[model samples]
Target chain A: MPITITKSTGQKELLNIEKVKHACRRAGASAQLCEVVGQEVKQQAKDGMTTKEIYEIVQGIISKEHPPVAARLNLKDAIIKLGPLGYDFEKYIARVLAAYGYNTELPPILQGACTTHEVDVLAVKDGRAAMIECKLRHEIGIFISIKDTMSTWARFLDLVDGSAIGKCPHIEECWIVTNSRFSHDSIQYGHCKNMVMLSWNHPKERPLPAWIDDKGLYPITLLPQLEHNTEKSLIDGGFVLLHDLATADPSLVAQKSNIPEETARDCVKKAQLILQA
Target chain B: MPITITKSTGQKELLNIEKVKHACRRAGASAQLCEVVGQEVKQQAKDGMTTKEIYEIVQGIISKEHPPVAARLNLKDAIIKLGPLGYDFEKYIARVLAAYGYNTELPPILQGACTTHEVDVLAVKDGRAAMIECKLRHEIGIFISIKDTMSTWARFLDLVDGSAIGKCPHIEECWIVTNSRFSHDSIQYGHCKNMVMLSWNHPKERPLPAWIDDKGLYPITLLPQLEHNTEKSLIDGGFVLLHDLATADPSLVAQKSNIPEETARDCVKKAQLILQA
Candidate 1:
């Protein structure tokens, strides 16, 4: 049975099982499991199912077999929901790095030989610092391209040169972190340069979703009940991590974010579920 | 005779004396003088004159009476010829300030409260510094809009805020110098904010052309003999001012720029003529 799925952008297209298998492989699912899930998803497919609905069904089948892989797949869509707000996304990245025992400097605008460059997040530990460039995408189809990778490398090089000239502090490592997938050439170039790149799924060495899941530092945007004006309020109040929201008093969310007490309680409940999920 | 004049981009337009008169008026030419020059230029027009040729005829007639006013008019087109090289233009601006007894720093990237910004030329004299933003345009019809003005203001504000916090050097004034004309709103906003804006014409007090002539520091691009590859080579060799080329030996120009000695000598001769003109 063939099925037409409606996308978030209101575009409808026939769902292809090959695409499903490809995404599953990219997410590191076993081929045998992918075949089984593909068959089950096709069986459950209907004419007017939304893409989100289809993804939920796929997640259900996949999670029964592999929960971590299921979480990673869902995490892609979850990160996309975190912006339009770029600074909020940067804070979220900081939270994730903090969980890994790295002290992050929020924005270090280092003077360089050629120019002054603003590094997104500077992670320091044990007298070593990594200058990081974070590229956050709110849209699903956007990819971090080779141009971005090259520019980041150039900025890193300039800062390193600046350090040689006593303009800025010395950086020991360079990293580029993004919520979206990487372009093929960018991944190849980054691998060749030994530059650490953490995207949605590339370099199987350390994909971002796995890093987040292992650290259990999910963004507050992932909470189901916290949205729109409340989300903006929370972000304005510098509340970014789900763990922080989950542990805080429900009345604090209501008072600070000006949401109803019932809604605040529901947000806390959702955040707790996400933490335990 | 109705003449067809080709623009730099190779598009042709009929030579209209009315347009000539309008240009003359905009350049602050007297009505009676504009009428006389308009008639004389029309009489001198041939079948296929270039726009540059027409401007020269207008300039020659105007210069006979008012040399500085003619230099101001000719300076606009001369500055336009300086780029596609932005860094060279910044150097040219620095040289202009140097001529006016201001100690200038090239490409100083100052850290601000919000971000790091690279100021094109920082002019300091007697314990006061002015951060300058230079906008160089290669194309003729393009005007510097209010958006550029606002962003420059924002950067200036951030740097001033940084100075308050002791992040960088204290900037006493903010100035924007552009080869092109400023938009009406940009001029109005600059006036309201007490910001110094030197464009082709708008800021009646010390406009860019007037300021350039006051310093007598003409860019080497203004030399008619220097164009194309030779212009690029001269700029690359750090020979931005015509006065420098006029003083430089032809052998040195030939060796440094790899142009023929004869061409180098011709460039120097032309530079001398421009200096005297």
Candidate 2:
């Protein structure tokens, strides 16, 4: 039977079980599991099915089989839903830094050589401070260009110069953090300038996704069925991570978000599964 | 007297006549001309002066002393004003190619291996066909990235494959034309793939600026006092090149652009002087 799969944007496309199976396999699902999911999905599928509906169906099965892989595949889309508010991204990064034993500040004004600069994320650990330039990309295709990397480098230099002149505290390190990939030139410039670069998939030694997974610091947006308003409330209530939700009482989540208790319970359950994976 | 000059975006800074002179010198002005212009500009300048106003004053002087240099300096800005309309840029590229003895088409639909691709500018000359990808940047700081280069290569390969399958004529060359610089990776990718890159300042042997200046095919944005609407009308009327405007009857241009005859006359005069220089 032919069925139209609707995207989160409300645009619809004809559902292709083969494509779904391929995606599942790419996410590290076993071939046998992929076939089983594909067959089940086809039977349950209906015309004008929303992608969220399809995702929920598939994720439910995948989380049961291989929870970690499900979380990894869902990460990109989860990060994207956190937006329309850039400040929240800064907060999220601050939280990530905090998990690594760094006392983090969102955006602090520090005197640069020429002017006052607002450093994105300031992390202090072991008596050394790092001025991090947090570049958040909502779109997957957007790569951090060389110009941005250069601008960060200039800012770092200016801040260092400020410290040399005793205008601000001396920074021991500079870092560029992004949720997406950096352009080749950016990577090269960062390495040459000795600025630590952390991206979603880079330096392989300490990628952002692996770091987030290790700390169980997934953004609240990663919880499936978390409404936009609820996400905002959770963030405002100082609950920004999936780990927070996984550990919180489901009733507390429902009260904070004004969401149905059963839905909140379901979300908490998914978060727990993802964290375990 | 010191004056704080302002930018179009309202950013203000102290005016420096020496900086203006340096700009003129970089634009190929003579030392004497630069000095004279600097003195004249300083005298005419006041606090709260905009960069646009300064450009006009300096351009007026340079066009009188060295028209070609004036045209060359104005080239980058002129090409920029051709947008918000990307199609105008493609047409501008077509005119440039035409000057080089190539008949060009804008966005001709050519079959790729799996899908139909709309080639940006297809140039035919000497019994060889070239598929050109015209990458235009509206902002100055944006650089063409490696992903774009790779996408163009993929399209070129698909087009070549299409020819193998008898879907279209064989393309003997693939070229990327941009009015901005390309990232290091883009340049490297182009070289490795043997794809010809023609940018504002790349491939050192022949840059876009040099090619346009050599052909005397300056875009009409070079006209100092050309109103935005009139420029659009002139471009729409097929008067894309400065050479075309310079050689056309002033009355004809006035009629086409719905502007006064005298203004058209002055524009043509400036164009002629620039060409002579």
Candidate 3:
């Protein structure tokens, strides 16, 4: 059935529902799943809206579908998008790399009982595969014991052994990424072949220019560079934290740079949530 | 009458009740208040505590004793020794002045809620007064807004008008310190007779040297001298927050520095509390 749809501006669109339904059945999802999503899309889709935003709306609806094969598919996509630990470490790694000018394709991280085990990030510059292992700085540099450091080393060893991702040929160079600095002994333990460690602590060699002003770019490497005198003068003159930018202090930053005052007030709501949690 | 007491390790000493009573009276506190603190400090305070720590213990007990008067005395002392906002702003200005080989006691900053006027700093060295106004930044080669740039000027105007910190009798040159490049407007605004605007944003003009390996030299002017390319870089590399170092992290750092953690923490805490307020 071909249907006419109207947008908020009074523009009209026509979509073929029968064609999509048949396509959905052929693709193995229930026809009802396609109908609900298709119906909503026809009703709400605006003229010239970006495909990515439309996809996001569909994704949101998928997460809310009843009897939920759509929800299962949403979970499947989420598992692929953000593997485990409530966030996709692989995606974050891809972001950090992208922010660094690397071409990368990343797979969902392999999940374990406690945390994600093997993160699958692929750096494809000029179509050559560069496999990376992703790690997050769950804790910001508060070291309780040496045991935690040793465990991270062991996880890398397991990735090297090819246990995290299922057996596959066409493997490339393995990169281990972390948000925190490696404890002194952990770096010593990472002396294996085909292993490169990138961390906020002891930033190893990376290919990013100092001109790019983002703080997280070459996170750890920049620290040692900053220990360099020239860089210090440049940064010290005009640095402001994102949080500080959002403050009510009129003299600290431009008014627009300050997020809406309500957003900061929302932090109080988050604090309340923590209290409730 | 003297009372005999045994230390935790069984060392014996005679305590003078009169001295204890007098110390409590000097602290404007009672014996019961002292006992309550003694119990908590036993759990919180460790061995080889300093006289300042003991004073803080007494002060904490007597905190309710004329809070405003206690606050005023501290404020007056900050004006005299530390300048406005403390953290050795006077020392930073002294270095800046001496760089051009000038001698100067800057005017005292008026400290109280009852006054709208505040001065950036009062520098006292070699028998002359250099009233200095300073600002800090984390970005390189950026312009600040006119509205945001007025606090330092407002404070300076307050001092010049003789409404802030009484009359500035030991008058010398007015110095403006900035961590970033001053806008064209800021330079014009700073162009009053006897005013010198110094931007730390320029490398040669940077009063601080690059790569100071000396831990003893870290100060306000010298801070931008260290080789940190970004704020997070310095923070993550264990650049301790003055407040965190003094109050919460002192016990942790005491393991490294020979100073008693409590006293170190308190000093850092007192300085930060004043800055934030």
Docking class of 1: incorrect
For candidate 1, chain B by itself scores a TM value of 0.76
The TM-score of candidate 3 is: 0.23
Candidate number with greatest TM-score: 2
Tens-digit lDDT track of model 3 for A4-33 = 544333445555546445433332355677
Q: How would the candidate models be sorted by TM-score, starting from the highest?
A: 2, 1, 3
TM-scores for every candidate against the unseen true structure: 0.47, 0.50, 0.23
lDDT leader: 2
Please identify which of the two predictions, 1 or 3, would achieve the higher DockQ against the true structure. Answer: 1
The candidates' DockQ values read 0.03, 0.03, 0.01
- What is candidate 1's local distance difference test score? 0.76
lDDT of 3 by residue, B1-277 (tens): 3334443324455543344344453333446765555555454443454434444554564555434222322321222222223334444444445444455334455532222333556665566666675554443234543323333443344344553445544445566665445666555545533356666332344422221111112231112112223222323333333333334465554444444555445544543443332
Q: Local error of candidate 2 at A225, Å?
A: 12
Q: Report how far off residue B274 is in candidate 3 (Å).
A: 32
Q: Residue by residue across A1-277, what tens digits does model 2's lDDT show?
A: 6899876435578999997887677565779989988988998889888877887788888878887667756876877777766677888888988988999987568886655667888899999999998887886558887657756765676678789999988898889888878888677767766889999778877788777766667898877666788788778767788888889999998888677788778878877876765
Q: Local error of candidate 1 at B62, Å? A: 14
lDDT of 1 by residue, A93-120 (tens): 8878988889997875778665566688
- Residue B238, candidate 2: how far off, in angstroms? 1.2
Question: How many pairs of residues in model 2 come into backbone collision?
Answer: 0
After superposition, the stretches of candidate 3 with alpha carbons farther than 4 Å from their true spots are A1-277, B1-108, B111-116, B124-128, B141-145, B148-151, B163-170, B192-194, B202-277
Candidate 2 chain B weakest ten by summed lDDT = B107-116
